[model samples]
Target: MERIELPGFQDLRVQFDYDEDTGRIQYRKLSNKARRASSEAGHVADVGGALYRVVAVEYPSGKSRQVYAHRVIWKLMTAQEPPREIDHINGNTQDNRWANMRDGSGGANSKNRAMPKNNTSGACGVVWDKATGFWVARMGLGGVQRTLGYFENKEDAARAARSERLKNGFTERHGLPKSGLDKPQTLEDTLV
Candidate 1:
């Protein structure tokens, strides 16, 4: 319930003139001291203890249009806490709303998750290689990549991956089994 000063509103690129008679702000092509260029597009105002960035501008001609800067402001105002990092829950940047947004750590925020499907590569899997000298696992989403790491062995690497997922509460799909590699999957493997 602390009031914070809104930033980046004083210097705007697009010019808007305030109408005293109407008591409403309007866009004007001319620039003046009272009518400085808007650091953002469309219009912005505070409402119900929250600031809302106008998504569209209604021109004198009565045409409505979407503005990017206004949308950015809306997100800034509505975010939980300046959004340490903004995550698009559905993976679309344009869908910026309170429900679709989440605050995340920079590392967690960069996960490039795609729609889950049966044949999705690496969905329920972790990298395993005994002879490669190091073990590595990675997950990607939205052009962002995150790596688990370089373990001494495949088993060690898998354990590390599973531990990380569990700590983060990520559901396990096809990683290592909980019992470790103590029990072989097949009778032949056990005999060997």
Candidate 2:
């Protein structure tokens, strides 16, 4: 069992608890008023409608430091079922509102990203080589590199690449064509 140190009500007091089931530390609040302690400890408490946890420490020279009570409480409350992965919808770590949090697999987590402007090549920005009968996609984030594969046609390769991007929460932006600019001219364009 592991114990977690949480902030206490006042001074350098702290609380401790263990998560026997997962071998993790658990910290909760105490009802009694805190007493001054030599070292820092953590504890949990309720604030408004939310639960919070904190840790406090005092140096030998009598200087003291205190942290908020929300740290441990948020983890324990939200991780009860523990999703494979947790996503913060707005991408903010501190915005732990229940509605802002979602449980999802790694793949699902990736599908929610906004595509970069320069990433124009495969499903998100990939193109297939009709001459070689190979599917190719490129990533421009750090450097340009080709992700290639063999496919029957450009569409097959494009779909596969798009599926991969979608799983990681990456969505195409600015109405970019999913299959790139090489798509065959449609009759609608001729009429226009």
Candidate 3:
């Protein structure tokens, strides 16, 4: 999804500020601070495995609420609430850096997913075609599967699959190669 700058963050009290360059959000105070000066921002924090700089802000009512540091920064940076799903471009969920965050779609996010736990093929979009006796090259783009082709050599198939993924704007790191299964085995090695 395309990124846009929203304009509702100003509605909230000036208790937090975000630095897009550094991807840091300074929280003026904790939720329990009891309406302290907004000038005193809190330090970076890790809440529930994600980096957060908690802030005490009024939301829904007069009472202040403790919000996620990333969401707070997102609001401050974009002046809007982020989409329901946010993408951490670098694959580091805790890296709430502004450049690392973007409005995310399921298709785009899935394209950045780590290789499946049960992946036997070392390449991203290659699988052995048992019926055809050839390595098949295919790509999944925007939920649509496009067959690249079949090849006798696994390396060639892997190259074809990787190319198809790139042509569709998939990240280079998407479905990164995991094991060494992509390398061709020698006949002698197989005999043992």
TM-score of each: 0.32, 0.30, 0.65
129-192: candidate 2 lDDT, tens digit per residue: 6687666643332234446456665565555555454443454321133233234434232111
Model 2 ranges with Cα > 4 A deviation: 1-81, 114-123, 127-192
Which RMSD values do the candidates have, in order? Answer: 15.2, 13.7, 7.9
Indicate whether candidate 1 or candidate 2 has the larger TM-score: 1
What's the candidate order when arranged by decreasing lDDT? 3, 2, 1
Model 2 CA lDDT for position 180? 35
Per-residue lDDT over 34-140 for candidate 1, one digit per residue giving the tens place of the 0 to 100 score: 43444333445454432444434333454545443323333344532254454544444433444555554464444423223432223233454557756575544
Top-lDDT candidate index = 3
Q: What C-alpha lDDT, on a 0 to 100 scale, does residue 101 get in candidate 1? A: 52
User: In angstroms, how far off is 59's CA in candidate 1?
Assistant: 19
